[model samples]
Target chain A: MRLLIFLARRLGYSIFVLLGLSILVFLIARVMPGDPARMAMGPRAPEWVVERFRTEMHLDKPLYVQYYYWLRDALQGKFGLSIYTRRDVSQDIGEFFPATMELALFAGIIMGVFGIVLGVVSARYANSWIDNSVRVITYMGVVTPAYVFAILFLLLFGYVLNLLPTTGRLSPGVPAPPTRTGLVTLDSLLAGNFTAFFDALKHLIMPGIALALGGLSQEARITRASITENLQRDFIALERSQAIPERVIMSKYLLKLSLIPTVSILGLDFASLLGNAFLVEMIFNWPGMSRYGIHAMLTKDLNAIVAVIMIFGVIFITVNIIVDLVVSWLDPRIRLGAERAK
Target chain B: MAEALLEIRELHIGFEVYGGTLKVLNGVDLMVREGEKVGLVGETGCGKTTTAKSTLRILPMPPARISRGEILFRGADILKMGPKEIRRVQGQGISMIFQDPTAALNPVFTIGEQLMDAIRYSNSQEALGRREIRARAIQALKDVALPDPERILECYPIQLSGGMRQRVCIAMAIATEAELLIADEPTTSLDVTIQAQVLRLLGNLVQEKEASTILITHSLGIVREWTDRVYVMYAGGMVEAAKTREIFARPLHPYTQLLMRAVPKLTGEGIAEGIPGRIPDYLNPPPGCRFHPRCPYAMPICAQERPPFFPRGEDHQVACFLYKG
Candidate 1:
């Protein structure tokens, strides 16, 4: 009962924070010295066209009035028409959001599973050759920026190696697979054409690996440090003295204790992946929301930008809230304090 | 007439320190019969805890080298057992209660979860279901005299007070019905009153279970009150071993005498003088008798040759040149 109440309260607070973040991003984007209507019309357009465009885009209204109207429309799921595409912002988001989500999900899995395993192996063999090798690889991953890695992967895997398709979500000749749940990978599998599914997986490999490169190294390093610290603790020694199975000690005790901090940090890493996906999307032309957001920004599509930023902000906050609840659930020490505060 | 429950024959534990190998326990011999309560008393840095850890085969590996030791449990050498066999003995044949309960239990798990895990580890093949396991857990809690076992089962280690946590630790250690229990300074972290209660509780449990116990502690008073036999250790070596009354009544080793003098009396002026000087560094411990430097009556031979155990009376053994044949 108390856990339910606590989760509800946390969810309520998260929504409020997300709303504030949205407003801040929205106002900042508007206040930037750019006339969306003029940008849309171009320098050669007539004055009347620009004026009419401004009014239609709600740019002629007072700042507060524009915010209030936008908030009301957004609450009703009506993100006003995009200045560039002249389509509903909701429609644009609905089309591209799942693509971005698919990339993020696959990248997150890569980062989480492989990153943690490498970390544990490295920590368990600290100062050994294996530990040194993992350190070198992790260092290389950390130092090389994601875009640089993405470009390198593109060149190596696409042009030089010819192992994967150079660009896009699928091969050009293949028909866009049925969109049952909107994720290309899932949709391709659901459509049951093994050929298209493999093509999609092949295309996803480079971008997903590019997205995961930096975050995976960081996650692995963090897990290693946390697990090492846990190993030094007296309880761990006591557990060993109790003659608990090594597998149980590693999997049940050490891994469970180490995951609290790792999971929390991974949540933030996941949110950052969304931000990083923009560059990955541009490089690969993946047709995700990041590509849409960048196109919207360049064209000064105010409604499109606001809608994209708001969705991203909501996702970031929701992931953090979920991470917090999971950490509390896995470790009673955190939950007891939370319960007491309630 | 019955064989000893645990026998340590010429036990030698050493560690590879920076300069060279440092011997922590040198040819220490001791025995505990079934159902006997033995107290191993020593100052800090002595091999008392090392001896206990060796008996359970739980000493830290690599640097901690048990160069020579035959730890026989029911005439079976524990050191010869495989990891699985050794583990089976741990928490089943002989369990241990650590000095600090707070540091012993995992902070992440509920008290009940930890208890059940330990219980289940010791007895998984019994096919006890979750409900049955929980009932057994509650019974274990009740045995430790913890109030509101159900509430405690739901609470984490941080929720319970220090004394209550110690009780929980003791309850878990005793739940498996091990043949021998090695409690290493189990009440050192508790307050005086709580310490007394825990001590009393331990004594009663030992009696009820009819199990042998090796209580590793520094307090001679605890030894006097709770144990049947006491082994006094100084400078990583056993100085004396005897029936508890005999050791307290007539301490043969000078170190033992000093330790007895250090104990604060409850009824008297209570001004007790603690043994002066710190324990010798183990890396370069003295050659002959390790305690000779601290012993007031150190003879020339005491610095030259290690003294072997000499019989003083029935069930009494002292390692000092003064009593040596």
Candidate 2:
């Protein structure tokens, strides 16, 4: 019951934040120096045609009026049409957002799992050659941005070594899985197509690694530092004195105690990945929303830009809320504002 | 005579600090016989806690090093024991009641789960059924004077009060039925009234179970009331050690005398006066006796050579030039 109440409060705050983001993005996309209608129609298009497009979009109305209709339509799940694609912005997002979500989800798995494991390993072997190596690797991972790793990885492995496929969501010849979840790898597994599943997984690896490396290294460093500090804590000494096996101490006690900060960092990293994904998706031609978002921004596609921004905002808020819930679940100290369900 | 339950001999501990080694424990010797309550008392940072933690060998390495020591438990050299042997002896042979109850028990685990962890680690109780473990956990809590042991088992550490949490820790220490219990400043974090109650409870439990203990604290009153023997540490060196009554009755070392003077007596006296000099820096400690800089009767000879432990009375020893003759 307490968890539910806490979740509700977090969800309420997320809604308020999303509302603010929507207004901010709506204004910023308009304020930028470009005409959405002219970009949608070519520069040689007739003036009457551009004017007609603007009126139909309610761009002729007052800014506030335009926002009001935009918000109302959005709340009803109708994002206005993309100026360039002439397709419903919501529909385009529905198709494209899943790809980005898949990349982020897979990357999030890599980031969280490897980050924590490496951190714990480093801390356990603190000051040893192994620990020093981990520190060096994490430092390099952090200093060099994720896209640099992506490009290097592409050249070295994708082109030179010919180890993994670098481009597209699935192989051209392989029939795409029946479009259910929109994440091709998962959908392929769901359809019991092991070959397609492996193929989709192959395509995911490079981009996922590219997107996850920075966050992974960051998590490892933070986890190492936090766990190292926690290891000094009295409880650890007490546990050691109690003769608990070293494995149990690390797996259950030390890891659980040290992981709260790591998980919190992961929340922010996942949200930031939405922005980072633009480059990775473009490089790999993964057909995620980031690609669509970049195309929208270049053409001054107002509806598309606002929709994409709002979507990112929503995702960011949701990740934070989930992280909060997970932290509270893990660290009983943070479980506040909930009556103990007696 | 029967073998000592725990013996820490000529122990020298230091930290490999930024500039140089910080000598924390210097030529300290302590012994706790079976069923005896020994108090290792001193001001904070005097290595009273270090001596206690050393027996378990849980102090962090790199920063901490036991340069020289032989800790014998049940005639086996703890210092020479490998990791596997050390693991066998830690909870089964010796248990520790930590200082801070707030941070000692994990906040995530329930009171019951924490208690069960101790019971499970316990060699004797590991073979018991689940029902038997639960019953013993409840019994352990009851032994510590905790009410509603069953309900508390489900509640998280955040739900428990400081005293209650400490009682839970006490429960864990006692649950294992380990031969030696090292209560390091156990009551320092409790209310005065609660402190007395806890000390009394601890005293009773030690006596009833016939378990040896090393109570690490700065409380002279507790030592006087509960401990059979007392070792007074000063700047990581043992200044004086004697029967609790003997030390209080005639504290020969100036440091020990000053420590007794600082304590407020229940009867008439001026406000407690602190000792004149501060604790010496471990990295660059006073050359001779670590306490000589603060010694009221510091002769020129006191700065030249460290005072040997002089036998004073029945089982009484003082390391001060004043008592050398």
Candidate 3:
């Protein structure tokens, strides 16, 4: 019941956050040095055709008025039309967003699992060869960009070795599974097409790893530092004194305490992956929304730009809320809002 | 005489650090007879806590090394015990209550979870159910004179008061029904009024259980009030060991005598003189007696070699060159 109240309060605050985000993105898109109406009709189109496009889009109205229309249409699930695609902005996003979601989901799993495992291993064997190797790997992973990893992986796995699919969500000959979640791998399983599922999975491997590496390394570093510090805590010493099995101590006691910080930042890391996916999607030719978003920005597709940015904003906010819930579930102090002991 | 429930013979502990190996405990010896309350008294950094932790083998291994020692519990040598055997002894044969209650109890775990963890792990022989373990946990809390054991079980450690946390720690340590308990300055972090209450509760619990205790403290008054025999330590070495009454009546070691003089007397006039000079740096401690530099009665031989325990009277020993004569 208390958790419900807490969540409700958070949700209430999220509305304000989205509202603030919409206003900022709306103004920024309007102020960018381009006329969406002229761009939509092309440079050769008559001036009157561009005027009609401007009036239709409400681009001639005051900035706030334009935002009010955009918001009203947005709330009603209409995001106007993309100037570049010449289709409804919502439809373009609906078609493309799922591809990005699928990649992010796969990458998230990779990051969450490998990051924590490597971290625990590093901390357990701290100062040894295993720890040294993990430290070096994580350092490189953190410093290097996702695109750099993506390019290297593409070159190594695609051209040099011919071991994995380099482009698209599936092989050219393999038909896509019926769209259930728009994630080809999951959709393939849902459709019970084992061949397509394996093919989709194979294609997912390189890009998923590339997208996950930075966040995974970051998580590993955090988990390693947190666990190493927690190992020195008096409670851990007390736990040992009580003869708690080292395995039980590490898993139940140490892991739980160390995961608090790691889990809290996880949402942001996952959200940031969506931002990083733009280049990765382009490189892989994965047909994700981020690639579409990049094209929209280049051509000044104002409606599509606003819609994409808003969706990303919504995703970021929603992820944070989920992370907050998970953290509260893990820590009683946050769950109960109890006073900390001196 | 009762059989020694725990014995530390010529124990030496060191910490390998950035500068050098810190020789923390140098050839220290101690013994706790069955059902006896032994007090290991020393100022801060004097290896009293290290000694207690070593008995349980709880000290971090890489940093801390028991260079040479035999921690024997009942007839078996603890240092020689395998991981399985040492674990069996810890929390079952011997348990410890740390000085700071807050740091001792994990902040994240509920009181019930932590207490039950001790109860379950210590009694791994019996496959006790959750309900049975919980009942025992509630009983343990009640034994400590805590109000609402049920509610407290559900509460995080941060929810309890300093005294209450210490009581809970004591309850957790004793809940295992271990034959021996090591309380390392258990009341130091508590309030003065709460300190007495906690100490009294601890005393009562230890007495009721018929469990032996090794109470490590810097407060001479605590030793004078509670222990049967007291050991005084300076710079990682034992300086004096005697019955509590004998040590207060006739302290043989110059360090022990000066330590007693340093304690404020309730009836005596004016301020008591504190022992001058801090404990020596362990990285390069003084040769011979670590206390010779601080001892007023320092002799040429006192700085030449470390003194061994010399008998002063029946069951009384003082480590000093002066005691040799």
Candidate 4:
């Protein structure tokens, strides 16, 4: 399809972003205070053993040469040894990435759907009390931090009211569902463990709400503004003059035409959710890759930190490409512009 | 006139602004006879477009308020009609094509989709099949003399030229077979050559459809060439009204005479001069004659009190102190 070619071009740009991200991650891991080889050998290790470990780990080489070796090994899917976990960085990531994906996807869905609906309703009833009330609520949501909300929910609902769990992915008695997909909720359903499935879902609600709040409000504001501007366009006047049903005009013409900017914002919001979700994950004790990254940061684990950044870079780029494709599909002018350029 | 198709009587309109109400139209009267082309010429912000929009009852309220007036279509007041009643007349009894064609069309839709929508609105009485609407849309395109109507249908509005988009807008209005068609500066957005072509196309199509047309333009040349009657407006009130030839030959009001002098001749015998002063600020418009500030023959009464329309000739009227009863 013509759109496939557009996607291919976007994919090329995303790959370039990943490469830049890889280099940055490599440098950041090097600059942080801690010798990975010494840390690995331990403080009590003999001097010769520490020296051997440094040479083996390429600490003795220049930074560029070390980067080259790391890049080469990385390109082959070998992220090297994690000093903290004593496992391959890629293997640890393989386990945590799915959990992160599941949480982020759920939060994103909540943000996109509720955010856009609130925006449309607000714009539809602009200046009414309902609109004013919704504006106030969304503003409050936007100003509150995700971790603050997480802590609040934990205090109010989990600790005080005793209505929900405070932290942890599942209760002590509930077993982690058998790992087909590694996403607890989905795997629980696959294993027909209704009890575990519900327990996992209960744990997700607080953190999910926290993670979704900021994106939701931001998306709503953007959607409201874009749609309000679109409502005043000359084409809307044309549609009204044509005597097309108001329902059809609002849905088929107004909403679809106005959503391009909103969709673009949504894609970027999805990418940002990764960084924000890290806090939600930490506060709520959700086991996601970001939590693992946090652990690596505290311990100054080199391979693990680099690997996490690279994975995040990949996910962010992928989201951006999908968004570009969706936006192009919404507006035919983009494709026409491509043709003109050609 | 023989059973006027549309008549607007003593129409007053204003906008609610921050500090005060901005009066856009003050006691404006207009009449369009069956199958007659009437030109409404005015400077920008002279309430010409507001008057046209009021006829359809489509002006955005709060910002636009009809303080007092009656807009009558076929002797029935449109202001009194409910939404359903208005809908019946919107695309069938009356339709409007706007100034900027590109802005008037939704960019996301294909030409065919928008055209089909218009066709269905016009053919609402008959539950026409998709095939019938598609055929009529194509036929409407062909009527506008647009080439490759079939291929053009699939193309988005951005792909079409400015002139082609104007043609599509014209086609949509004419295809409805509405009794009264309103063209508000339909050629202003195009280049000079394209402007003439679009005007000619509009003239022919309106004549063929036998629809009464209300052409609002800044160009006096357009008014003289296309209209049977012309109304010259200044500052929210009608300055002069007469048959096109009569107005050009012997314009009664001083504003009308000055407007005639503003048009340049092709031979370039004399310089064409523009009228002095800007349009009055609507919030505090000149109390009496809205054009009194710029009138060469302004009398004491022209500023102290407003001039009522007085008959100058058969079916001709001018609002000025020199002719008022």
DockQ for every model comes to 0.44, 0.70, 0.75, 0.71
Poorest 10 consecutive residues by lDDT, candidate 3 chain A: A333-342
True contacts kept of each: 0.43, 0.68, 0.67, 0.60
- By DockQ, rank the candidates, best first: 3, 4, 2, 1
lDDT of candidates 1 onward, in order = 0.85, 0.88, 0.91, 0.87
lDDT tens per residue, model 3, A1-342: 766777788889999998998888888888999888888899999999999989988989998889889888888999998878889988898899998998999999999899999999999899999999999999999999999999999999999999999998999899989998888988999999999999999989999999999999999999999999989988999999998889989999989989998899899899878889999999999989977898888898888888899999988988899998888778877766632321
Q: Per lDDT, what order, best first? A: 3, 2, 4, 1
Among all windows of 10 consecutive residues in model 2 chain A, the one with the lowest summed lDDT is A333-342
Task: Give the clashing pairs for model 3.
Answer: none
Q: Write the per-residue lDDT of candidate 1 for residues A195-226, one digit (tens) a residue.
A: 88888888889999999988899888888899
Off by over 4 Å in 1: A1-3, A46-52, A123-128, A228-244, B15-23, B123-135, B148-151, B265-271, B299-305
Docking class of 1: acceptable
In the range A147-230, model 4's lDDT, one tens digit per residue, is 889899989998999988867778889988889997888999999999999998888788887888888998888888888898
User: For residues B282-307, could you state the per-residue lDDT of candidate 3 as single tens digits?
Assistant: 99999999998988889999899999
Per-residue lDDT over A63-136 for candidate 2, one digit per residue giving the tens place of the 0 to 100 score = 99999999899989999899767899989998999999999999999999999999989998999999999999
Error of 4 at B98 (Å): 0.6
Which DockQ-derived CAPRI band holds candidate 2? medium
